[model samples]
Target: MTADLDHPRRGGLWHHPEFRRLWIGESISQFGSTISQLALPLVAILIVQASTFEVGLLVMFEMAAFLLVGLPAGAWVDRMRFRSVLILNDVLRALALASVPLAQWLGVLGMEQLYVVALLVGVCTVFFDVAYQSFLPQLVEREQLVEANAKLQASESVMQISGPSVGGLLIQVLTAPYAVLLDAFSFLWSASWVAAIRTRPAKPERRPDRNLRREIGEGLRFVVGNPLLRPIALCTGAANLFGSMATAVFYVLLARELSLSPGLIGLLGSTSAIGGLAGSFVARRFAERVGQGPAIWISSLAMAPFGFVAPFVQRDWTLALLAFAQGAMWLCVVVYNITQVSFRQGLCPPALLGRMNATMRFLVWGTMPVGGFLGGLLGSMIGVRQTLLVVAVGGALSFLPVFLSPLRRMRELPSYAATV
Candidate 1:
């Protein structure tokens, strides 16, 4: 059966059982993942005593899966049950993360193991994220896409607010390696919730002539050929590329150069989530007021400048400056994400949802590893602060693609058929 895309239920998404379950699981997973985000790099730096480039390499390994198997994974996912994929990936990630704590307890944890774990977890995450995005269109009506994404983004923001603080405290007590165990448990919890989802999406029809390469090409062509999607992809990819570069050594800058404590750094990270939470609340309204298309570019354009503030941060006001910059950056990011994601969900055909989402992710997120490597290289060459300045300037200009596209004229997005 097709989803009820045109008619939204009367009450908010909380009234829907399946969506609620998905939200809860995702919420728990997001919280745990946030902790790992801080804890993992800290493990490399503190426990293994990794250098600046090594830390960046850790980031690279974590996101490198997108560049490797991203295209084929999408074609593969299009032929499977999204919920099953989500559950399996969650379990795999949990297992991978659990290995870190086990190795640490045995006094055998090393940088190499960390790299392996990052790569494994990254591979699992790539699958989970693609399936997760594809699954959403089946879970909720298209009309509820914005509201649903907003609520989900809000939960993620809340996790961002609290997760790092908790992670920092755990690191103080249990140490960074042990702290990752919490994330492992969180993944299992997420898997259970996802498995419990009752509304199963009908499987896509398989054709006898199915070919992986052709399917992959179709996804790529659809994304690159579309007017709205093309610019969106370009804008997001460019933004993420430079954003990754700036953030590659951000913790290093804070902990080593700025000499900030983990607790203070966590606190500053939590402060940034405040803007994400606010943006979650405001994203739907902002889109309605400014028009969805305008909201996409305007939000990005407005927030891009705050990134420049990072290079100027000092010890005395480091907390304030970091919080301000991250807060402003997250605010726009959430709004843009909510608006754009909902549009894409509404635009793509159900048959192409998996491939479309995967292609979009591959295009947008694939730049992360490249940027991470560049960030590390630049940090080592010029200095962390200098790299931040360059990243900021480049990121600010990334919005030019969306601003110049036909998306600027339309108040609302059209479906794939209409666009053609």
Candidate 2:
């Protein structure tokens, strides 16, 4: 490696070979995941002829592992190799997803299989996601965290932009069941690239005092005790809880109520990714100008109006309104994510990174299961449009926790090095 690669600063990760492999692998992986994101729900909804409530449960099962094993997995992975965890999970998820295509081919596919596969994939995803975040700091320099995250987010956003259209097309051609095969293959492709990565993060040191419960507590305390993380968690948790409700039922509205074709549904969903891509394109500059703290709250506030606009979408020129609303809301979402996640990664001590990330994930993502349940139940009780309106209003304002807290006062992403 050249000196530039050895001691990169100021977004010099672009010169790093191993990072490129990781980036490319993850980008493809994300595209595959996006295909499943559409395919899975479609399979549940159309293939099985599931109700709105079943679709909600399917979504819930997909994320339920975060609640079941989230905390413990963090403590577990802290002592394991990041590469091994990532690779193992990728293969596991691939196998789980591959089952869908196989079952569909065999004419034995049903809701039970979908639920089991969702649950298994979710368990693997919890591990992969936690490890993926914790592993990145090991790949690049501390200062490059923002740029690295930006690049990754940009690619992810790009996948979001293009993946859905492709997914919808594939679903149209192959049916949703077979379309999921791409996601399964994508996981295998990712694992192969990860296996080739030359830069291995050092194995975490194991301590004799490492009790699982104590380690878990230590991680939780780090998040809860930290002034910055606490509010971020609360705010993110609320956002996911409310936003996921709409996500659970949004496609149902598009497919069943609005009677959109798969191609149109995918095209509409791609609008959100367009916003995310735009946000990723501009996140660094925006944060630099506005300061990360202000950026966070302002982005949150921007989401409110966008959130209000989504439920009002109709089949006519109002379609453009959905695009604008979804685009604007996701733009804010991406900006907020890039800002806060970069801040969180840079703020933590290396020893606590896994636990800290795990705790944060648990807090933010654990509510999703509840949200999925609520989306289904409420969609059933109050009707789909009414449910979307309710969740949109709550999700729109979910940013209040961070907006009301110290984040609003800090001019930039505050350095917590001294505090940690």
Candidate 3:
């Protein structure tokens, strides 16, 4: 039985039946999500005729769940069945997304409906993600995490690479509003596969002393009180904040100012996917050579200069600069995320996995909505190009937290990271 699992001494995750199920389910959903990431906004822009602020607000609504339920949701997920939570969210997201095209077909679709759908999706995502992270430890041995995460990220990379271009063309052919139906159906497919996963996650250890506030506080302290985890949170949080600022208006810039078609805009999205694919491909080897800790900070600074290249993009040959910058950023981030996520996952106690991941998500992804709003505000004030420059400048320094930490001096991180 052990020999058939994802043991390195065994055949790795490919031989792990349950992990393969999760991967196939997640990969298909990711492809759909990737396409919808482009299609949804295009629906807002082209069909709904949303303004810049409205578009940014759309982004905010999509991510607002992290701020609202990110903490307590983790605690709640800890108590629930992982399979139930996963399947429920997948179904809910499918229903919510399906509503988009239905409303359009009925000639009743509006920004209000879109915003509500985005919020519902965000809420489900918050729960699903927390449960998913915690569920992984039960699915495989501790040693298999990096390999598992890399494979998962690799599939995600492929989806991202192809999804945008395909989505862009689909948007043009089917019209953006109807294009969302693909993602709607994909969620159903994801749910079916998740229901088929045979690995039953044991019911969580029950504690009579469980309190939401106290549990949340415990998770917070575990992250914030630790030197290594603290810096990663800060670095990731900062990068996301500033990155969101530029991305808030990125579509607007491409569609409105640059006058690019949906197909072209989507092709540009491929730059990051290309980078992400490279990062996933080389992540394990790169960490081995450079040291896991070094990989984190080195990848961070290596892409710093790329941020400055984005705002300088032109309609001509310089388009490649934006692509390069986007790709470089994704490349670095994928490597950084794969390493750091494995580190943190391996670091926490099983009971704390949900909370630790939730706390981390709050710290990192919570900034996205705020940044989106800021990007919109700044775009109105400083113009889109200048706002991107600000994002670039601030993003260049996001690696400082990790760089200044003790991890900078270490070679590899042990699962049992003892540094305070």
Candidate 4:
């Protein structure tokens, strides 16, 4: 049975039947998402003629969902069946994305309409993300999580590398709204794919206290009280804050400061896929040798050095190489996430997974807007180079959470489960 199941299909999790289906669906969705990432901004720039402040406002609107919806939605998701939630999220996102193109075709595209779509889609994304993270542990055995996450990361990495290039092409060939149509299709595909996954029915428990404040508190307590989760949360949150800060100025670096064309930037960013793919492969080995905890620490520390190099690139080619390094740096993040997520999932009682996942993300992503706002502010005041240097310095400081926590000494994913 093991031999037949393990037959190398695509040289990794692609060989597994269930994982293959999930991967294909997710990949398609990612491609579409990539198109929208490019198309949406172009729509704002070319169609709406939005100003920098307007663009920043739009970004804030999009990200606001994470801050506003993540915790509550996570609490709700823990009490409900996750599969249906994921399916609904995809369906809703598809409809939301479709509205943009449809409205454009009807000659009624407006900033109001665009903002609404961004806001709604972001809300949907929060729910989908919370549900998806909680759902993974049920799909695979505890032992195979590293491989599973690696495959998932590889898929996302591929999309990250290729999605923008493809999106850019579609935008060039078919205008921004039409380019978004591709992503709408991808969401539909994800919805259908999610509907096909089969898992054992969860043993329903009494719904926790219905008071909104109490439920939210319960979720927060679960995350804050967990031995392993608390430190991971703090470390990841700080890292996310720093990364968001730097990303806020990346486009300015490419377009306004570096004087690079969109096509070149897209191509340069594409090279990051190789680094992600490489990092995914390396992750499994690292976990085996040093353990998930150490892997997380190493990956976290490595990211700071890699990020600092981008501002120093002197030439276009060098910039691209640095971008590849950045991609690899991000890949390390993916590996850390996979390991940590799996460990968390395996250790936590399934009943608490949703809230735990949500709580962690809420705290981590909650800082993103602050980071982005600071990024833009600092970039404007001090210059993009100085802003990034600051981000790098702050990002390096993020490792302090892990260093101070028990993760500093952890050698591997604990063989005997340690409850949160």
Candidate 5:
């Protein structure tokens, strides 16, 4: 490290070696995981020819572990070395995913196996996320957070565009279970890359709060009672719940009701990543100018409109254009999310970050089951398009909580030294 204070790091992304490795590994893994995300459901529905209810159950099962294991995992992560936790998580997930392909080769792949794999992978994912977040602050200076987040958002946008196309093609050629093998390899790659990055290990046995309950409660209070985190939790939770509802029925609407080909839908889906990329490209500049809070609010407001437009997608390339628009809205969401994470990482005490992240996700992601269930119920009764419309309206409208709260003016993370 150079001693010149004036010459600070240039090229936000290029400055941090660990962040660069992490970003590269993450980007590759995201592409692979996104493919699995699409392939999993397709396998459930198309290959097994499962009913809509079964598909819904599969999705719910995948998300259920987050609810079951998140907080406890958070407590555990706080007591361990985050780098080792992340590496172990990747390895576990890789083995679990690798099994699906092996089972498929043996002609014994079943719904039970799929459910079990989904649940296990979800559990590993929860641990990885909590631990990884706790480890992020040590990788870069606090001021560089927005830049790092922007880079992450950019990678996610690219994955959004390409991952589905690759997944669809792989599924077409190798079958869904085999497609997951690509994800397994990606996770292994990620673990290898993470192991290569050198970082100071977090000292084990440094428990901050006594008793799991108190630690959990401290984390929860930070998120739920904070001036910034509270509204973010509410808005994002509503978005996830309703967005899941709308998306749960999306393939049925596009493929069955609208008579879209899988290739075309995948193509349309790819266009959303373009919007996401563009949104990320602009978000850092926008956030820097107007503040993180306002950027998030803007993203929140746009979410519903883009979602509402889905049902109105006309035939021909118009559908592609509408998909592109939705992608742009998704980009806004990515920017907002990255900004929020950057702020949270910078503001929270390092010792409490794991619990805070876990607690926040528990509340936000816990809505996934409800959304999946509602999507199925509503699609069955009121029809898919109508159901999606309702979710779009309801989810977007839920942003009112953040808009009315103290969040609107919170432009940046208050200095870490500032006490709540």
Candidate 6:
């Protein structure tokens, strides 16, 4: 069944009370996440004086849960209330983050504790993300999906631009472990906002005969069997894989090879957020003008090649070139993400929404760790620049899957039933 677009809340999404609550909570949570992203590594590096290898392991553990429990988590989320899941996960993450400061103050903060926090937070995040995506369709009209997504992405981009700087300042003042307190507080604030939202759609009826394995298979089949979803998944998965490959050594090349200062590197990093912000603002208009299908593939195909500029960047005007390249790449990514994710949410049946989102995330995001490993290995053998070149070229070609599919010709997405 399609969502009712003529509902009283059908005006501007910003004016929708429940949507505003969700958006505010999400924006705050994302900002906190950015803070923690910086704080986590800093806690290990600055506070505990962790070895380089130990820091790498910390990063690995943080993301490892996605590969471990990603698929099953979706099936589980499908069985529960999305809002409750969201609230509970936020509390869990807040409590998890809170532990670090407590440990630090108690003089018990250690690498082991850091590892545990990373693992716990990662697991909770997996559930939260699955439910978050699944819950959005229930909150807004089908017609508002694109606009809603654009607003959310734009806010997230704004946070990305500013969060790290805020994080750095907090770290300098409060120290790394204490800086994590900001993220803990942010999660609590997010939970409060989420708890205040009262306009949730009714939960899907539960069946007594539900089988986890079968439900997971159904989700997998839906994504793999649908012609439109399949190519999109392949294209996304490829892009993520190669993007991770480049990311593994991206900073090393800048800091070690290019001899850029930390401040300059941070500035360059922030440029992507500017591009992302612009993309978020423009995505809805671009889709309206060019058609969502063409916008999806064309954005990726035309802009991803700029990624090639990274490996060749030098200390001169090339640095600006690098910033532009990263910015352009992110611009395309945010635009494509807003359009495609809205399509997925609008296209999937409510019963399958959680599982579908989870399965796709599994296929797409699950590649990062593997790609990181491969990139590390390739960098060791062929060197960082060559590995980056490989990533740039491969990422550029990732769009081919979607470009060659029926999506290349369509101007608008078809209904879920029609696709099936």
- Top lDDT model: 1
Clashing pairs in 1: none
TM-score of predicted structure 6: 0.90
State the lDDT of candidate 6 residue by residue for 1-420, as single tens digits.
223333544358856878889999999999999888767866775678765445545665676677888899999999888999999999999999999999999999999999899889989999999999988888877767888899999999988778877776777778878989999999999999999888666776789998999999999999999999999999999998887777656655765577655446556767878899999999988988999899999988977779889889889999898888888888999999998999998899878899999999888888876776677667767887899899988887999999999999888897665555
Model 1 reaches what TM-score against the true structure? Answer: 0.96
On lDDT, who's better, 2 or 4? 2
lDDT of 1 by residue, 1-420 (tens): 324323335677877778889999999999999889999988998899888888888888888999998888899999999999999999999999999999988999998999899999999988998899999978887777888999999999999999998888898889999899999999999999999987786777889999999999999999999989999999999999998887688988988898877777778889889899999999999988989889999998998879888888988766587788799889999999999998998899888888998899899999999998999888988899999999999998999999999888789788655655
lDDT, candidate 3, at 154: 95
lDDT minimum window of 10 residues, candidate 4? 1-10
Estimate TM-scores for all models.
0.96, 0.97, 0.96, 0.89, 0.93, 0.90
For candidate 3, lDDT tens digit of each residue in 249-363?
A: 8898888888899999999997789999999999999999989899999998888888887677879988887898789889999999999999999999888899999999999
lDDT on C-alpha atoms for all candidate structures: 0.89, 0.88, 0.88, 0.75, 0.79, 0.84
| Poorest lDDT segment (10 consecutive residues) of candidate 2 | 1-10
Q: What is the lDDT of candidate 1?
A: 0.89
Task: Using TM-score as the measure, name the better of candidate 2 and candidate 3.
Answer: 2
lDDT of 4 by residue, 1-420 (tens): 244443535566556766666677777787788778767766776678665445545556666687988888877887778888888989999999999989999999988888888889889988988888777766655566667877888888888789878777777778888889889989998888888865534645765546656777888997798777888889988998887777666666765567665566566666766677677777878877887688777777777777778677765568766876777677778777767777777766776778877888889887776676777677767877888889888887887777677776788656324534
| Candidate 3: residue 59 Cα off by (Å) | 1.0
Q: What is the lDDT of candidate 3?
A: 0.88
Error of 3 at 216 (Å): 0.9
The alpha-carbon root-mean-square deviation between model 4 and the true structure, to one decimal in Å, is 3.4
Specify the poorest-scoring 10-residue window by lDDT in model 6.
1-10
Runs in model 1 lying further than 4 Å from the true structure: 1-9, 416-420
Ten residues in a row with the worst lDDT in model 1?
Answer: 1-10
Better of 2 and 5 by lDDT: 2
270-314 per-residue lDDT for model 5 (tens digits): 887888888778887888898877877877887666777776666
- List runs of model 2 lying over 4 Å from the truth: 1-4, 9-11, 416-420
Instruction: Judge candidate 1 at residue 178 and give its lDDT.
Output: 89
**Model 4 score (lDDT):** 0.75
